[model samples]
Target: MTNDKKRWLILILLAFISALLLAITSTAISIYLYGNKTYTAKAEAAIVLGAAVWGEEPSPVFRERINHAINLYQNQQINKIIFTGGVGEPNEAAEAIIGKNYALARQVKLNDILTETESRTTYQNLKNARSVADNSKLNKFLIVSDPLHMKRAVLMARNLDMDAYPSPTPTTRYSSLRSQIEFLIRETFFYFVYLVFQI
Candidate 1:
């Protein structure tokens, strides 16, 4: 073959290999992230990860997660609900407070609701909630959130040695799709870096 033709062929082969590797990596990550299941049986508590609260109310995404946790309580799947989120802004109201109020409005008992209102991110949410649960001598619990976030939550919980299962709530269809794609891409890059450092 001509030298130029051989170089072009080599470039095409490299491109094909790169595409295949990307596809495989994406598929594996998707399966890993999407395979977590919601809690189905009784547990010590249901921990709802906080999202933004709009004017002392739960955002739509936050509301969905709170409602799902409430449903678990109503069904006796868990005895307590722990809402975790920090204050969004000065006087903006804590995400946990908003989630707690949302459940209270739905008739969840006051004492059964707990709040970890100092977590500004998912890792912190799980960390703070787990600390409270540990103090209370609770063992198993459910982590409630958007589906795309469940796997990360579960992994974090396991890393902290908590017996946690995911219980994702319904998210807005278009938003869920968009969020999933964005998270998948971002996490793929993050995980690649993580792997590089063996983290």
Candidate 2:
């Protein structure tokens, strides 16, 4: 109403906007830095998160994630591998089943392979994986994915009350700055959305 009051209101609004921007920027930086990191924490199972499966085969990204999990399994860092993804189209193999088969072919023991074949998104993946983990009396999980996807994937896992650790693939498909930043920004956005709006 008054000039001084209007000036104070404008100042407060600017400060609020500035704070939000700073928070968002800080989170983005954290996500970017953390995504590039690899964890050494051992867990009961490595959750190989799903990516595109080309018909009956895994896409490059999915293969990298599965290979990383395979290495963990071979190194005895994890006792089991839980692959998560469901059928995306008619006649398409569910990603979890395809990933399990790949690991089996690569010599991962048959008894150590598990699948959650109903998840279509990251949240659903972890959500359903948690159920499988619960049924098996397993609590700790190593979340395997592309380096750029580790943060949110771990967030979802921990949010589901699992002892979750990050195990991002060392060789990621996002090999360029443009691809890296694009994924970083995208994951950061989803991370904030999940933090603010979901458990």
Candidate 3:
């Protein structure tokens, strides 16, 4: 190729890379900021996204989400709790069931809790929760999860046409700066991927 043509191509490539980086950086900032905010509005139910389950108990990360939902229920911000997750292995207990059991042990009434035990992903979580909501005549929902996970979760909920709001857990397992940064990076990439599929 000619010198001028080669130079122009390089410049174009550089510009494209720069723009992509800027977009990603801006998304990370937005996710970080948005996740940090918590919604306290009243809703029909608090949809708790599942995390890890340690045997029969909830993992620390999962416990926080369930605790946040219980708080919402106790505060009268929500009337029902919906837990969503399937088992990680074929014969293991589902994450949703584990969360429900945890809440029950903590005195959340059995009649007030619902579990969707077939979802293995965030998208599946909200999607399956929507079905439970429909059956129960629950309309609005507070989407509860870890702080850094709220942005993507809420976006997916909205995309599913759910009347959803963010309700991030104030206390998160990702407490250290290093852990938070790592979560932000992971969320940033997933958020961008979600946006792309949305388009």
Candidate 4:
């Protein structure tokens, strides 16, 4: 090809690469910033997204999320709690039930707690929780989860057309810098996937 044409082609390629990198960097920053944010508005219920259950109990990560929901309940920010998760392999107990029990032990009333033991992904969790919300005539919700997980969780909730607000757990088990970075990378990738594929 002519030198002029080759020069233009290289410039275009460089621009494209730069734009892609900038987009990714901005997205990561947005995710990080949003995760650290909290919303304290009152909602009809707080939907505690599920994480791994250790045997019959909540894993540290899951417990933080449950604890956040409990705090919301105690503060009267929400009137009900909806726990979501299906059974994880090698553990017969469902994540939702385990979360329910954890909340129950923490003094949350059984009458105010709901469980959907069929969701295995963030999308499914909110989708199933919306159905549960509908049956109970609950319209608004506070989506409770870890800080880094809030961005994706709230996105999925909004995509599901649910009136939801983010309420990330003040304390996260991913406390170390390395672990927090790892979680951020994982969340950023999933956020991209969900944005592009709506999955």
Question: Which pairs clash in model 4?
Answer: none
* Global local distance difference test of model 1: 0.81
Candidate 2 runs further than 4 Å off = 1-6
Question: How much is 20 displaced in model 2, in angstroms?
Answer: 1.7
**Candidate 3 local distance difference test against the native:** 0.92
lDDT of 1 by residue, 11-122 (tens): 9999999997987587557734564555687898999998888997888888888888988999899999999999988989899999888889999999898889999978
Q: For residues 76-150, write the lDDT of model 2, one tens digit per residue.
A: 999999999999888999999999999999999998988999999999999999999888988888899987788
Residue 172 of model 1 has an lDDT of: 30
Which of candidates 2 and 4 is the stronger one according to lDDT?
A: 4
Q: lDDT tens string, model 3, 107-183?
A: 99999999999998899999999999999999999999998899999999998999999999988889999999999
Query: Highest TM-score among the candidates is held by which one?
Result: 3
Q: For each candidate, what is the lDDT?
A: 0.81, 0.90, 0.92, 0.92
Over 4 Å off, model 1? 1-24, 27-36, 171-176, 187-199
- Kindly report the root-mean-square deviation of model 1 from the true structure over all alpha carbons: 3.9
Q: What is the lDDT, from 0 to 100, of the residue 150 in candidate 3?
A: 90
| Of candidates 4 and 3, the better by lDDT | 4
Q: Give the Å error, residue 170, model 4.
A: 0.4
Backbone clash pairs for candidate 1 read none
Candidate 4, residues 1-199, lDDT tens digits: the string is: 9999999999999999999999888988888899888887799999999999888889999999999899999999999999999999764799999999999999999999999999899999999999999999999999999888889899889888899898988888988999989998899899999999999
Best by lDDT: 4
